[model samples]
Target: MEYPLAAANACLNAITTVALIGGRVAIARGNREAHKRWMLSAVCLSGVFLVCYVMHHAQHGSVKFIGPDGARGIYFLILAPHIVLAASLVVLVPKLLWHSFRGNFDAHRRTASWTWPIWMIVSVSGVIVYVMNYLLWR
Candidate 1:
């Protein structure tokens, strides 16, 4: 009954988190090209993760937490924001990318200031959720 896809998704999230961090660093260092590469990689990986996530959930449905009652609250707390922000990324990411693609650095940077943090939170929380659901809880 274990879904390997859950683990794969977790790995994807981890990589995406690294890519987002890399993008941030590249921009801070004024390496626009590197920033673009890192951000695009993060976007591509995120897209793949989204597809895989849907596939896994469609086949297996949602994974319920099996951890101790004390930790169940923590798991739900982590999961709720992850779900909400993850859904928002579908729109946020594309809008942020569009600004960059259109050569509007000012707007892009302004948007990214907020989008990046939210994306990072979702990516990191996703890995935490995966571990809690499949490893710790199980």
Candidate 2:
């Protein structure tokens, strides 16, 4: 993997992890502003990751995998969840940002209740995928 792509992926993971923390704080304190800021930042960060991801894939194609015993099944298992949630985040984060920005606090909160956990999973799983591709499989 290119250093730039790896770096961006790492940053995206870090920022989303922070956003999850900030999101918990927002929920506890009812801090809508902070919630909006952190969530939006997370979305933007993920967007950058997406762009870098597509570019890298387009330029270099995907890395092939060879796994240990049962590792092939496990790898696909992990990959399914990550891909599903990542796609969800791509679609849903904007809806969340829109609702929150529109001052629809109730709707935002409702949507985010679902979005936050999924986003967290996506972020963490993304890191796992990266590690598996570059480190474990290498």
Candidate 3:
């Protein structure tokens, strides 16, 4: 059976969120190795999510937001930023990872400080969009 791609994407987003939080906590505790592991896992999960997301959209086209006017505005409010960051991550994430892997801690930290919140927002708002478009409004 064909699974619901939106739901699958949401699950990936949640997984990425948990990994991101874990990575952040690891770093905050000064556990560099643990932070690296968790953040790498997040990157891998997000990479998978991107592939699936693109495939789903390619196959199914856009899933329109359907709801009351107020809800529609709210949905776009969340979606617009999510989309912009999501696109930015295609470059930002790889650059962040490269800095980490190259032992450039200062550069890594600098970029990660910016990348983290944006990534969190994109991951979380993805689930919010899924819920609003698929579950709540369905």
TM-score of every prediction relative to native = 0.98, 0.87, 0.96
Query: lDDT tens string, model 1, 33-94?
Result: 99999999999999999889999999899877889999999999999999999999999999
Which residues of candidate 1, in runs, are more than 4 Å off?
A: none
Task: Highest TM-score: give the candidate number.
Answer: 1
Better TM-score candidate (1, 2): 1
lDDT of candidate 3 at residue 38, scale 0 to 100:
94
- Residues forming the 10-long window of minimal summed lDDT in candidate 3: 1-10
User: Candidate 3 on 1-138: residue-level lDDT in tens?
Assistant: 243877889999999999999999999999999998999899999988988998899988987877888899899999999999999999999999899889998999999999999999999999999989888767
Per-residue lDDT over 1-138 for candidate 2, one digit per residue giving the tens place of the 0 to 100 score: 444676577668877788778867886898867866776677777888888888778876876765576677777788899898888777788898798778897898798788888988888888877776666766
Residue pair clashes in candidate 3: none
Clashing pairs in 1: none
Return the lDDT, model 1, position 29.
Answer: 100
Error of 3 at 46 (Å): 0.3
Please report, in order, the local distance difference test score of every candidate based on alpha carbons.
Answer: 0.94, 0.78, 0.91
lDDT of 2: 0.78
Between prediction 1 and prediction 2, which has the larger lDDT? 1
